[model samples]
Target: MGLIAEHNCSMLLMDHVPKLLVSSIPDSQVVKNINCGRTKTAQIIKMLKIEAENELVQQLTKRKREREREREREREREREREREREKRERERETTKEEPEPAVTKKKNYEVDLAILKIIDEDSAGVSGLDMPEIFIDFNNSSSNKLLLLDEITEFSVLVVSVENDLEENILTETKVSST
Candidate 1:
């Protein structure tokens, strides 16, 4: 009789405890009086399983969003790094494009010396004695004058004409005068 009583108590606990735990009902009598079938139990289990799956899906979505944000941050860092590298490359190229200071200084020195030499020669010419004048006419042609300075006191002059008619006229005049 004691064993049968214990068995009945265990059956009562098994039937009522799960409903009480799952529904959080304060009244044990309501749980015992409720007629819960296999379909109802299965539906409750399915609802709990669906809730668990929803929570898992929400966690996975949060993790996926976090990963996407991290990827964007990494891409931004890479873009910044590339910009800095390009800036450095541009600076290097600009430095390479400029002339070196030493070479520029040498060129300026050579130009200054040439200017000074021309000034000195002009001053010497001004201080020299009187020079002779020679005339050659080229009304319809081109001509060039060259001065040969052999010494400080002696010089020679040469004139070149570019037209055949002028040369013939000069030669004929010279020949008539000489004959």
Candidate 2:
């Protein structure tokens, strides 16, 4: 429909317009100057439309920048979470590699009980009893059996079989020098 004929354009005041227009157009005749005749009102409406479009463009630019910043923050958070997960996995692998020192005195009759205790502890891990096998080659002529406790520095991880009094080596490595 056309502009409302009943709505008096003259009734509308200049004070309602933005303060920027007040400096350019006199308050008494600002509305009348823009809407001189029926043809001029159309021009005034077009100017207002251009100003609204500019405002919308600025608002859209601001929204786009905010969205970009939010996406960057989310990406940073995801990267940190991945790093934390990797660190945890490394720590778990290290713990598995280095066997906790067992200070049990050598016993003959209680060997089965000791083996059972070790197996029970192993069951708590994710791999459970899945470990490597190792055998003591007593007959190996190259094996140095007379090395002192301090000189014989080696760390080995083994899994004890619950069914039998036997241990399977998971890993073997030379320990760090005590000196």
Candidate 3:
């Protein structure tokens, strides 16, 4: 017979083998041989099916383990990125909060005073005396004092002194107006 016909005959035999064994007389020696062959074929098919199921289960378990590991790696990467971002934000806030320069404190005060001086009627007007604007600077813990001399129809003289409570010297300018 040709190869195709032989294969078909074998397939037909395999299909009928179980039925033939079931219908044969139990005491016959030929039936015992056929039953043994059928039991071996059924055992082989069951073994193959079990092996296929085991392989499939192993593949699925391996894939699940790989997927879990990938997810863990992704989570670690995200946590690292979040930490880096928080560190950068902290650095930015620190840079933005710069220290300010120290400033010295000081107190200021002002006083105004008027003075009148008596002149002798026998004294003539003084000549060749020029009155000019005066500026003085000094340092003291006491208050300032001013003295003015007014002469009748003659030139006037003014004296000013300032006291400073600070560590630095104080500057004072005095201007005298005549009426």
Output the number of the TM-score-best candidate.
2
lDDT of 2 at 39: 61
Model 3, span 102-139: residue lDDT tens: 64322112222322233233232656534432433322
The Cα RMSD of model 3 versus the native structure comes to: 23.2
- TM-scores for all candidates: the values are 0.40, 0.42, 0.37
Tens-digit per-residue lDDT, 1-84, candidate 2: 112223356334232434443343323332333443656655665564566567668879999999999999999999999999
Query: lDDT of each prediction vs. the true structure?
Result: 0.42, 0.45, 0.46
Clashing pairs in 2: none
Q: Which residue pairs collide in model 1, if any?
A: none
Clash count of each predicted structure:
0, 0, 0
Candidate 1 global CA lDDT score: 0.42
**Stretches of model 1 off by over 4 angstroms after superposition:** 1-35, 103-179
lDDT of 3 at 45: 41
